[model samples]
Target chain A: MTTQDTTYLDQLEAEAIHILREVAGQFEKPALLFSGGKDSITLVRLAEKAFRPGKFPFPLVHIDTGHNFPETISYRDKMIERLGEKLIVGYVQDSIDQGKVIEQTGKNASRNALQTVTLLDTIAANKFDACIGGARRDEEKARAKERIFSVRDEFGQWDPKRQRPELWNVYNGKIHKGENVRVFPISNWTELDVWNYIRREKIELPTIYFAHQRDVITRNGQLMAAADFLNIDEHDRIEHKNVRFRTVGDMTCTAAVESDAFLIDDIIEEIRSSKISERGARMDDKVSEAAMEDRKKGGYF
Target chain B: MDLLKFFTAGSVDDGKSTLIGRLLYDSESILADQLEALQQSNRKNDDGTIDLAILTDGLKAEREQGITIDVAYKYFQTDKRKFIIADTPGHIQYTRNMVTGASNSNLAIILVDARNGVVEQTIRHSFIVSLLELKHVVVCINKMDMVDYSEQTFNDIHKAYSEIATKLHLNEVTYIPVSALKGDNVVNVSGNMPWYTGKSLLDHLETIEVNEDEKSPQARMPVQWVIRPQTDELHDYRGYAGRVSSGSFHVNDKVTVLPSGVRSEISRIETFGQDQAEIHSGMSVTLHLKDNIDISRGDILVNSSHEPIVSQLIEADLCWMDTRPLDDSMMYLIQHNSKQTKCKIREILHKVNINTLDKIPADSFQLNDIGRIVIKTADPLAFDLYHENKQNGGAILIDSRTNLTVGALMFRASVE
Candidate 1:
């Protein structure tokens, strides 16, 4: 036996793998929530390390808002195919078509809030007892108060005041019928940590994460990706800009930052010295002060 | 860079949140948008200063009530190391939250109000820090500016805290005079306090050596999941997966499964589809034994030479965290690592009043009460003492009816 020094990244990875294994071990039915973003992609790599050689004990679940960047969906499909794992997608458009949720009208309308219905429906349909998410506490104020094994009621509501006390490394995953847990493997990780881990592990991400030329329109001082789903008015001016997304969400709500960070190293450096948070460009959260908390209480991942 | 996790605990008015805000602000860890939000928030102090407490009190209810309801985890990093700060609440009712925060922390910062000196909350936090067996503690005597940055006030508070520390068996205690509001002696040394000679709070935190406890030399890996690929390319692959809880396991090392006491030799160590010669503590990997033995989740794989105690009856100290008191007639689920079993509270030995550090006779425990109790389990469990190894020794009690985690238990001994 020799004394080995573990780096900060190694420790974080070890903690995440441990959590992933715990979710697999404790819950009878678990699924990894894949968003094709760097965080969830890092979760995929960690899951591979957690239970590889053998198939993942759980499948991957993705709630498609139908307003996502096509590149992200393609990346998600390719990764799932490469891993030889099952991917379950719950489409928000189906919910809207089925009258389960109503699509918002006019400007600032997005499928972001409607994703909660699709996600909850998917969880109930599949009876997933635990859903592994890539949410980090450093991302938002509401996230900072969450437990690793956050339990949701039959209605999929998160009661912030009544969270289970998580002690040591032991997470209490015990729940009755109809109750499910949201497991966050990287709750302690920050935005910089995720980018650094992606850089270290050389995990592939969507091309949109890198600086590329794309048609964008400025709204409310934010650059929104000019996608077909986005209802751009005749007065709205569209321009092609060299930009990259800090976070990937519904194209209607997600915003981009001007940058030339083409490589992972450049992105890591950008994050290390960047003034804005990863969630700063997220237009959905700008609706209210407690927007994330309100959405989380309603089962939005 | 290395990682260090610490938590801060003090009374409501002790400026715990302010100290945390100062740390983040001084380190440049607070982002521009977050700072802008803080500045724009309606909640402001009387002095027109941005209420840093709002930064940690995330929930609407907490902000409305001007209190912290649960533990809020914050992350930051310096050039030398990364830090995870569990900014726990200060209210007495939120003791469970503080316990949760302190359980995984390597160090604790117990804030002391210089004007008030050592109070009941300070003693309570100290007892919790000691009860959790944290290796390090920092007593940041804050609000020194209110006391005119006087060395005499700092010395008086230090003396009072040292007296309380003696009763709590706290050996590693560092005292620093600080004013969280004035930003004195928090991140940088204070020129005002010329008489005081010690590292500032942040400087000390950056330089402190968090030595990892020596591994027991006996490996313990609780089987978390069993993997069988059953692939066409590889016909038969049976692997037992878990994180190495303690020590290290080498390929071909003789091991024994707990309870069943099945013996086997490690045939291979696989991690991420690659075989490794050995794996150490905290590494999550799969192990394939040479011989097939009945192994399942909740079973522990230990070095054959050093086996843990397997018993049905155990005595432990439990911190009750539920509204309803512990009932002797009701059954609770005791979960240790991956193992789960039905347990009954045989007897309540004693409960300790954290403020006074006195053992009081009690039949049942209510919210935020720590008590020693004897538990009788339906089946035997493999475990080590909490002081010996935290990962293997700690357990939680889940209410069978509500399914809420009610108590945090640390095994004291196997009741004969």
Candidate 2:
């Protein structure tokens, strides 16, 4: 890559790398929030760059929904093994069994919101003072207000009004005992940047990210795959289509996009020309305008 | 996309939140659920007109009063640039919040009501923007539609603001008239303003090259943490972990660790699991030294030839953020980079009259006041003039008992 072309991306990468090191240096216990998505996967690569030749400075924590695509889980396991980093799984299913959370009853109910509880519980139990996430600001409105070192109160609530003034490269990670900061190293990156970085780095990802034939049904003008958690009525028809996921979340809510781009170069071209946003096909955010904000304030990653 | 960090300043009725909400809405950055919440909140109000500002001013009290209470950061990106927008409140009482927002910004967007034309708050915001040394400033005369899109009115407002702009002596200044409520000259070029030939706000934002000062002649790397295990696999290992604050460092560079006045040579710049050829500001890496020196957290490293001033006495520009007035005789926790030491306030030189851009001589600094002050730290901290090196010349003052960050201090000059 030419130096000029990668200047902006390199600057962003450098800033992210700085924040990652800060998390390791400032906090007593820190973890990388891994979701097997492209953004988090990109974060994993940056983390590797931040601390390599040795094991990761922090462990990888995944808040499992118990409804993930098997391909994603397999990819997650393989990535952890390849990097030789410790993985800690916090299960929403266990939370449900313990009555910490109640599963919603509906045709398209998701555990996406419920994961917030499990995530907070994990942080409190593990005494993690900082959790570095893969969230990008271009994804949502509420996320746009997030600080690189976002402070959460004792109740795991985000008070946007009183966040510390983050100036220059100096991030003040000072917080009270029970309060923790949600560190987002890639806060300035966009979806296209993530894809471009992946392409340049030749990072490995789940096979579901590429085009493949899968049985899916059209819902809400978006195509969703057939899965165990997804309920299909008798009249609901499923068709085989060449599709790929623009984003990977819980299986019930994330919709696949119609595409034939199997390679990274082709995917980059498709993204450049695509009119719809990355979150357009995701069924979860479509529930309401402030769904992400509400979830975020309640400690959702 | 290139990254641009900016701050927006406007009063309650200047439509700051609406402008941000419109940008997000027109760009399709708002999620489906967030749009639903906006609708639901509007429905609950029983008014057909959707309060677009609710998209940004999310607090319940802010919704009730229709004013921003504090600084809120918002992000959005176009084909060319990614933006980190710090939306600060307009109320006079929240000027400290505005200072906090503008401190880290490379650019500032100061919104003025077209009909009002450079009111008291406009001058106040512009003064603070200038004080912060923000290179680029865009003066957006909003609500032009309310004035029938008159070119004469726009010129009058622009002329009035130019006088203040001259007093501030900013690096670069541009004026644009628009109707934030009607979406003119924000994301797209407005057809109504035919007399204006300049680029739209988004166009300007996309092309403006932000001069991020990462390269400096005097290098500073404040040690944040020390990595020392001396494990069986890796014996005789001592690395200083910190982000490069300024300048560049190469292997075998003669460096001196501060606070202890110990000297050493750089053996390696470790990052990404491998030794790097060189390292610059904003890159966090571990430094291996040729000679093992006694260095720990709160110690700074610098070039031996170009040494920074090591003194306990300092004169600095202070932005007091706490509600309580700073105690002149009390010792405050002075934190510069990762170095924390006790510093007692020697005296207050002068306080800034933000509305007039005048320095009023004062004996003490109060809440939300910008002033010049003298401080004496317990230990000598290596630093330069704030205008020369932002990394070494700045620090934060915290109350010893409360541990609350009270003021941000930048070295004005050395106390000779």
Candidate 3:
């Protein structure tokens, strides 16, 4: 093989593709959790690589929070149609209406924590034994301790202290009835790695990732995108500026970073020299230092 | 960038958390607001000191006691590489937790207090690390300030650790002296000890080789899942989905499905829409067989000419992970490679005391004890010696009642 052909990226790409196939091979019923984010989008591309020219062995499921960027919604719909793959969505609004969950109310209330209810309900409803996610450990503290085939109690809660020991590349995905495993094929990939892969592969993403003019206001020291779900007071004083989201989540919770990088390469360069973490722009994590951990234990993806 | 995974084993007071906190802090990895909160929390405690360890030990009890009680993970990156650090507790009872943390790690950082020299816990941790067969080990003599930057002290600790290292089989051992509380020899080389010449902890980590065993002798791929596309575009496409456990495979390679012992030629190796010439360990790929093979999950695909031993009676090295002692008559699930079958403990040959590395005859195995056992599976299993190939030789014992993984096991030395 040529020197350039033996790169680590090539190795990682091959590994992820293998895992995507394994999920299809192992479980009785399995599905991919598509969030319309870059990580999941990369997963979609990997899925296509694993099983293309043929429908995916398993359907793609998205736990939809009614409060999402319109661009993401449009992009998600277009991708599903383009791929001609089945798209299953579980809505948080439905769960709330069904009294399965009650929306949080506060100055920074968001559907971030409530997504767990909808996600678990969807899993139980579909009887999916494995729900493949794009969650990378480098993204958060609690997620760093997760196993690739993380076993969840029948209740869908993750016990950080009691995780099964995963050695070498052997993943034990065994579980009893009513139990499920949350598999993360890209668990080893970092945010920078994700951006670099996106640039190298030229993967398409939502427009919100690139720098654009948006009406946003400063709240809790973060630039909150002005959306209908957000309770923006008259005194908040919205201003048009060039900003892009570091991450996509419940529209009310995710914040934007001021940047001028509009292209993938430029964004990669920006991330290289950037000082703050990718999740720094997300307001939801600011609820508390252990906010993500708390949400994950309660079954949040 | 190179992907590196490492584990940190040190006492709660050995400044492990602080060392990790420094890496996160100096790399500009933490958010500005999070740093602000950390500073605020430091002030809230108002102990007149910066508790950098708080950044890693993020549990309620840990925060209250100012110590790590469980294995916590942290990730950071430099321009050269990306690192995943498994910050494990140093307490003896948390030994099981340490094993969980080190199982996936490519290297281990065993921190020692320079002033205390090599303590019992240090040797215990090192022995466990060697027993786990981790390729790279870095012995960090921490708390250099406590010894007033004495090279003699650093050398003394290093010399003591070298003897301990000789007792166990280890490869690629390096030593560094640092003061985690003072942020020395962590992200930057320490100027206080100009006499010491070596790369900083991060530098050695950035350049260390990982998965060197990827090119080892045995080739194994345990089938994780099977994909069959019965659609119109691809009506008769069937592929075996799995990660290459060890070695590599290419298109047209003659392979066999284990247990079933069905021979087939690799028609194609596909990932996404692209077809690759070959695939290796750590890479996930799907294989298409030339013939119709009735294969499913829990099956292994091996080179037909280089098949593994398929046997019903075998010996295995077992690490009991359950509270309930292992019973010879009890039937448990043996998950070896990708295959799962009913099995019973035929006999307990002996148990190895992890502390002294000595074996004693025993009728049963208990929690956290390593022992040799003979087991008989209902179905023949494909396995290689654990010393020969970790991927194919190792397996987990699952309880029938709670379905909990009760033990981590390995292939035992054959008496034949």
Best prediction by DockQ = 1
Docking category of candidate 2: acceptable
lDDT of 2 by residue, B247-349 (tens): 8788899998887788998998887556776787666778889986788878888878777888899999998888778888788888888877899988888
Computed on C-alpha atoms, the DockQ of candidate 2 is 0.27
| Stretches of candidate 2 exceeding 4 Å from the true structure | A1-6, A218-221, A233-235, B17-66, B69-82, B145-155, B181-203, B206-209, B212-215, B225-241, B269-277, B324-331, B358-367, B399-404
> Against the true two-chain complex, what DockQ does each candidate achieve?
0.71, 0.27, 0.46
Docking class of 3: acceptable
Per-residue C-alpha lDDT of model 3 across residues B1-416, encoded as one tens digit per residue:
66788999988878888889878876777866567768778423234676778778766556778877667767677778877788988887677678777776889999999889988888778877876778899999999988999999998888888888988877579999888878788888989999988998888888877766467656678887666767776678887777788887877888988889989889987765557878776666778889997998888998876788888888887778777888788899988866788998888889876666777899887777777888888888888877677778777888887677887777755333
lDDT of each: 0.90, 0.82, 0.81
lDDT of 2 by residue, A1-301 (tens): 1122325677777778778877877789999999999999999998877665445778999999999999999999988888878999999999999999999876777888889899999999999999999988677656766778898988899876676666656677777899888999998887878998898889998999999999998877888888868877776689999999999999888999999999989899998777677877777776666666777777777
Chain B TM-score for all candidates, comma-separated: 0.97, 0.95, 0.94
Estimate, for each residue in A191-268, the C-alpha lDDT of model 3 and write its tens digit.
Answer: 877888888788889999999999998887889899877877777879899999988888888889899999988888
**Per-residue lDDT for A16 in model 2?**
86
Question: Comparing 1 and 2 by lDDT, which wins?
Answer: 1
Runs in model 1 deviating more than 4 A are A1-3
Model 1: per-residue Cα lDDT over A55-103, one tens digit each: 8899999999999899999999899889999999999999999999999
| Deviating ranges (above 4 Å) for candidate 3 | A1-6, A103-109, B43-49, B232-236, B414-416
